[model samples]
Structure formats: C-alpha cells, structure tokens
Target: MILHDFLPSGNGYKIRLLCACLGLNVTLKEYDITKGETHTESFLAINPNGKIPVLELDNGQCLSESNAILLYLTEQNHLTQQHQSALLPADPILKARVYQWLFWEQYSHEPNIASPRFWLTHNAMTDLKKRMLPDRIQQGHVALKLMDDTLAQHTFLVGDAMTLADICLFPYTHVAEEGGAYQLSEYPNIQRWIKQIEALDWFIPITQG
Candidate 1:
C-alpha cells in the first residue's frame, strides 16, 4: 500500500498512528500542501477531492477520507469473540457508539478545532479570520466539554478499551492549542486521555519535516 500524505496533518497522522499500532507497513509519499502539490493533476486523479492521506492499494484501488481509511485498514482488527481487538468492538451496540463519536468528531469537533488550527498556522490571522475566532473557540470548547465529561466516567469513549473513536478524535484535539487561540488545560479528562494515548505501545508521534 502507498499512502500519499502531508506529515503535519492530523487527518493524515491518524492513519500513520493506526498503522504503527497495527504493525502495518505502507510506503509513504509525502506532499507539501504549501507548494500546491496536492492540487496537481496526478494527485487529483487518485483523490478527486485533492486531499492528503489517500491510500492506494496494491491493486491500484484508492481510498480517501481519514476516518474511512482507518476503518478499512483496521477491518481485520474488528472485534470478535475469540479475538478482542482494542481498535474496534465486536458488539454491535459498541460499534455503533464508536461510529457516533466518529461522526461527532467530524461534524462538531474538527470544524471548530482543526479548521481554525490549520488557518491560524498556514495563514496570518487577519481581521476577517480574527472575527471568526470567538465562535470557533466556543464550538471547540463545547466539543472538549463533551469529551471531558464522557472521559471522566469512562476510560475510553465507547467502552473500557480504546477504539476508533479515540483515534478519530485524538489528532485534532491533542494539538488544538497550536493556533494559540485555545488552551487544552481547561479539560482535565481530555489531557489525561491524551497522555494515555501517548503512552500506548507502538504509538507514533505526529511530526513535520
């Protein structure tokens, strides 16, 4: 498998981290989004959306979208009575709960946290973007509160074990303060959860070159 990705991206990092945890090997093809490499004709052919973290299989099939790729790569790791997987649950209800968090992360969390972080890091905080910060911060806080409250009572999002839900939410939430507009210190449970993820065996650190 070949992974076309931007190293600094949380969405891309999710895949890298999962691969590390699962001991999966994939050849990585890095792209510098700042140079408009993702928008090139060839990349667009692989992913019409022109996004990073496009996974091309040995058969030439391609999969895009970070969460979707996570599901695909970890399919074999899904829960089974004989083999309980920490990455995915076997019970239907538990699986649904994982999906729920994944959806929420995309709709409520990523937009509020990840989008702002990207813009703040890549583009100067001009008057227009500055005006949008307050609302973005509020939405991010709301998402953080939800995660904090849930994590306070449970070790993981859906069940006693870590699942895809944590992977989906971790990338953006961990670095949410990078833009300097938000501070994660407000959510103690979240901070604890981040530490737990970091301590996992075979965990991969997200880095930029």
Candidate 2:
C-alpha cells in the first residue's frame, strides 16, 4: 500500500501512527501541501478532494480521509478487535460517543487548534493566520477545557483502554500550547493524559526530529 501525506500534519500522523501500531508496511509518498502538491492533476485523480493520508491499497483501490484510512488498516488484525475497542466500539451507545468526540476533533478541535499551530508554531505565517489569532485561541481553549473535563473522569475516550477517539484527537491537542493555548497550564487532566499517550511505544509526535 502507498500512503500519501504531509509529514508534519496531525491528520497525516494519525494514519502513520495507526499503520505503525498495526505493523503495516505501506510505502510512504510525501507531499508538500504548502507547495500545492495535492492540487496537481495526478493527486486529484487519486482523491479528487486532494487530501493528505490517501491510502492506495494493494488491489489498486484508494482510501482517503485519515480516520477512514485508520479503520481500513485495522480491519484484519487482532488489533482489529482491539481497534473497535480502542477506536470504534461494539455497543451502539458507546460507538455514538466515540463518533461524537471524533467529529468534535475534526470540526471544533482541528480547525481552532491545528490550523493555528500550522500557522504559528510551525512558523508558517500568513495574513489570514494573523487575523485568526484571537478567535482561534478562544475556541481552542474552549475545546481544551471541554476535553479536560471529560478526561478528569475517564482514563481514555471510550472504555478503560486506548481507543480510536484518543488517537484521532491526540495530534492536535498534544500541541495546543503551540497553536495558542499561551498555557493550558491549569488543565492538569489533559497534561496527564498527554503523558499517557506519550508513554505508548507506538506514539509518534507529528513534528518529528
């Protein structure tokens, strides 16, 4: 399989992290979104949306979207069962909760947190980024505080062990301060949760050295 992605992106990192945990040997095809590589005709043919972490399977089929790629990768492993446990739950009610947070990460969390980090901490500045500062920080803190509250009660997003929701959310939240938290200094639960994820052998930070 071939995985097309931008290395520093959390969305991309999620796919990579999952593949690593599952022991999938997918070939890496790096793209520079900042350089508009995904907009090219060649890439669009694979995914008209031109998104990163597009997975080209051995059978010549393609899977786009980070979460979708993650689900696909885990489908056949013992981790497959663990996958549903950690990422997708078997119970309809529990699964709904997992989906809720995953959706939140994409819509509420990523936009406010990831976008700002891509603009600020990574030193990729633009006028739009300059304009987004106050709003981004405000919304990001809201998301962080919400996460802190939830995590104060649960060890992971779903059951007692790690799940898809935690993996999905980690990339952006782990670097909240970089985007604009100034200091999520009081969210002790979040800090503790970050340490837990970091302790995992499969954990890989989006920005690698």
Best by lDDT: 1
Query: Taking the tens digit of each residue's C-alpha lDDT, what string does model 2 give over 67-175?
Result: 7776666555445553444456667898778778877888888988888888876678778778877897788889988888988888986657777788888887777
Off by over 4 Å in 1: 77-84, 124-128
lDDT of 1 by residue, 6-121 (tens): 99799999998888877778899999987889999999999999889899999999999999999998895544443245577767888899889988988999889988898899
List pairs with backbone clashes in candidate 2: 86-163, 86-164, 87-164
Stretches of candidate 2 off by over 4 Å are 76-86, 122-124, 179-181, 207-209
Task: Give the clashing pairs for model 1.
Answer: none
The TM-scores of all predictions, comma-separated, are 0.93, 0.88
168: Cα error in model 2, Å? 0.1
- State in Å the error of residue 62, model 2: 1.5
Candidate 1: C-alpha RMSD after superposition = 2.1
